[model samples]
Target chain A: MAVYTEIADEELERFLAGYELGALLSVKGIAEGVENSNYLIVTEAGPHILTLYEKRVDPTDLPFFIGLMEHLAARGLTCPQPVRNRAGEALGVLAGRPAAIVTFLEGMWIRRPRVEHCAQVGEALAQLHLAGEGFAIHRRNALSVDSWRPLFQRSEEGADTVLPELGAAILRELDHLEQNWPRDLPAGVIHADLFPDNVFFLKGHLSGLIDFYFACNDFLAYDVAIGLNAWCFEADGALNITKARALLAGYQRVRPLGADEIAALPLLARGSALRFLLTRLYDWLNVPPGALVAPKDPLEYWRKLRFHQSVDDAGAYGMDL
Target chain B: MAVYTEIADEELERFLAGYELGALLSVKGIAEGVENSNYLIVTEAGPHILTLYEKRVDPTDLPFFIGLMEHLAARGLTCPQPVRNRAGEALGVLAGRPAAIVTFLEGMWIRRPRVEHCAQVGEALAQLHLAGEGFAIHRRNALSVDSWRPLFQRSEEGADTVLPELGAAILRELDHLEQNWPRDLPAGVIHADLFPDNVFFLKGHLSGLIDFYFACNDFLAYDVAIGLNAWCFEADGALNITKARALLAGYQRVRPLGADEIAALPLLARGSALRFLLTRLYDWLNVPPGALVAPKDPLEYWRKLRFHQSVDDAGAYGMDL
Candidate 1:
């Protein structure tokens, strides 16, 4: 729930002049993306999302994100397509920040996703992976296995204060993951952060996936691992194997996972859990004064990591081998 | 930029069952009203604003707010009209809060309002006051002149911490306003908080006025005073008399102000300035830690109040005598 950059009306009118979007009807700051300011702008043409990239987003990587969305949408993937202005540029500057407008997707993300929603998300995820093939740009996952140790090191000193012996536990887990991380797997553009909030559903049907800021070149199965950690966990820290089975089955129906990818599921899940835990831990320990967004609890991911540690193989996730 | 209430997708779907809005398409938390959770919901029927009343708003006043809007829109004012459900009800409960859906107005509020915009706002405000006549449900202005002293008393101890001698100045101004406050002036439904953001403009035309939570029975001239303080003041704390002239002249073109109303303008403007000042001062001094909305600077109103105090008569506000 943020609108960091306030755009003046005249400035916005001037900015919209570059586009053939017609006269601006209304521009409302939407509580959507956390890293960037998003506006659900309505014009004489129709509704579109006007996003102003904040400092957190690397400008160099924006082309990749925008290009990936365009590529995916072009291949019949349900996603927001970047709308090019009359100048034939998809991106522009507004309020002294890099901004772009994308066609508004009509759907709401499910809060309490049911088994069917999970299945739909799985199918959609696989479809996205298939559609992302041969995208011209490549961006490495910044929060992948390699970045965890450096991220954990920054938050290590204060980690124990969050949970008992948490710092020591993370250090041990990081060492194990760094050594055992999968080197060769089916790699593609993965929506690294396919959280439930980023996936929209309408009338019990998967409408689309959004927030491609975290999309990068990574193991396609690693993206599924992130989805499992994000969607398959319950409030009591227990894994819902029924939903997991449904999710895995749905994905296999679209694009079957390789033997190596399936073999690495347990480790990938653990790695995904660690990735979120490290980021959340750093944010929790380094919350600046008067920050708008409260840091999510790192211990939730810690508990998730522990659960993955208990899983000995992909079978534990109810994957049909 | 706040979304205090998190409405579940299932719950929202169930809630929408009562409305013939054609299966809910999308609901996005909008950064609009401060005292309520507002979502820009779009369905087959079209876009509407769904607002959940927060704790700040009194539940008893909900009827007056909704009824007044209905009344005003029926009278041909270009404000948001309350949308009734199948049960012919405008209000309902959503996420344990009183909520209602209103037609979405199409226009953007001016960030830097020009003299023409001020004229439009002035004309529109006068139209609102006239249209609000004969509204059966009457609500007293909660933050009127009578409430200032008590409000100031709450923030008096820390007022000077915001500005040197702010507390003393406020106390003196409160006494002056309370004693000299107009009585027996023409009274009707006044949009007491007619700030620029509440008024929307499109293609150089006044589209509508919104946020009627502050609409109440008060002297219509006092609403003009608020408009003067809000739209006529430049960013640097100086009054733009040319804008003020256009504003007052525009209002007179609709419903001419009586000599008594004109004479009371300066004192009413000072009182209006003090009304906002006291509330802002209280909020500034009493901001809760981790509160999402930052308290507006109280001294901005203090400066406006000081300027109002220097005005001798309505002519000083560029009122044509």
Candidate 2:
């Protein structure tokens, strides 16, 4: 976990008292999160990821994650299947922290993401959308544009740093976009973060997708827009043509994009970019110093926000917003 | 708050019974955080950022935050000063969540960050480090290189999408960095996320630095490396020479870089990038459907990791890692 807390091996063993993840080989604490305490756990049952609920995540909502995994695994989605205990619950307490044991996924997150990987991501996302059908639990994409502004308001004090007119500009964009947001498209659960690191590759072929914490059902095409903004944008803040094309074309192969989805692409992509920008902006202003959690570079999202703001139409994203 | 329970404003009013935020004018829900349910509150005390602590932060820790703010504010740090209750407590309860109000900072976050902005940021960070003395509190920069693997392991089960080799590479870098990390230079609390957005600028001058959540007492020089990886990097993943010169020169004017710190620059930058990559990578994999939070672009961090990995010397950052 990103925060500091003492967790001795013996203290942890009690938390795993009834589970069968095999013998605990190691409980190395994970350090790159602001929301949870994670440990790399090696066990006889095999390698598993152990997570202790950190700030922001509700223990009540733990079931959603646990149940989602169970459901996804049953549907053939290659994800970490949560291990159930003797009482049949997949979650438990470890060292007084809400905890769970998740099977380890395998693959290397490529440092140099290639154009083809973008396409592979696009294809995989489409397949995931189709596969997510019939899941028992339900959650709407909580971050659709209607919800974007309120996040900006959280950091209202710092709105003027980059834009002399940030508050007004954001308000105007929200009003305009709200009036123009699209409706009616194939909707289902989506792998929102299709960055190469989230898509596994074993020998250059897609292996298993992991990290379902931000998955949600929304405009299926919005997921596509999110991917485009993420996978197609180059480090210099320029959109890569080959990468964009491959990603779109690959996704289209699995789940054909309708004209409306294409027409809404740019607006949705801007919204997606703003979504990240706003969150990063808030985080940049709020995280306490000397706290264990790492704060993301708020400027990167600012960079992406600038790129999105420059776009006046959907065509910029290789789609028709 | 991204996943707040439906508690009405009036229902949450009682929790505000104790604290004095100076006549709360309005409460607007922020739907994009993993930790706290925040409200943009306008009050007689002025616009304030109101937060209802959700999961990660404890009610007991409120004093630390309150004291932390008071200490920093006392030192001339331009950030939100925590509002306290009649009993000298800066925290209380709101809607069943631990809550408090912080004065809103004013200044817009720049959307399109410029090279000059980097210089301002460098200067501001140095100012922060210099200002963060003992201040009657002690909290470590828990996110030092030692914390990386533990966090990666928590998401390791299926994180092969971005783990294994990345973790190992980071481990090796950590070893090299640990052996050579600067220790004798300046040491103090740092605004680690001194990205352009986190620093408030009134006109061309940096009026304040916001977001001390990741603020910690660490090797002050490492903070500079974090800035280099962030503000000084070009959009193309290469070091932007002008920004690098401006930022470093600006910081040097304030704190003056030491030879050991300069020599350790590459590894420090690599550590910073890897730290972010691991977190972004984990979040990328864990997004669940319908969660309002947008997963950050792991590719961005991945690219950063690659860039840092490619740097063989501290001079790559125009310093001597």
Best by DockQ: 1
* Model 2 per-residue lDDT at A286: 78
Candidate 1: tens digits of C-alpha lDDT, residues A1-321 = 433678998889999999999999998988667789889999988999999999889999999999999999999998999999988999999989999999999889988878998898899999999999999999989999889999888988998899889989999998899899989999999999999999988888999999999899999999999999999889888999988988888899999999999999999999999999999998889876656666788889999999999998899889866
Those runs of model 2 whose alpha carbons end farther than 4 Å from true positions after fitting are A309-314, A319-321, B1-321
Candidate 2 residue B234 Cα shift, in angstroms, is 50
TM-scores of all predicted structures: 0.98, 0.49
Task: Give the TM-score of chain B in candidate 2.
Answer: 0.87
In candidate 1, what are the lDDT values of residues B171-282, reduced to their tens digit? 8888898899999899999999889889898998989999998889999999999999999989899999999999999999999999999999999999988888888888
Q: Encode model 2's per-residue lDDT on B120-234: one tens digit a residue.
A: 8777778777767776666677677778768767665655556456555555655775676555766777766666556665445666665555666677888888888778766
Clash pairs for candidate 1? none
lDDT tens digits, residue span A84-176, model 2: 777888888866778888886655444456887888888888888877888777776667777787777888788777567766766777787
Q: What is the interface RMSD of each candidate, in Å?
A: 1.3, 21.4
* Best model per TM-score: 1
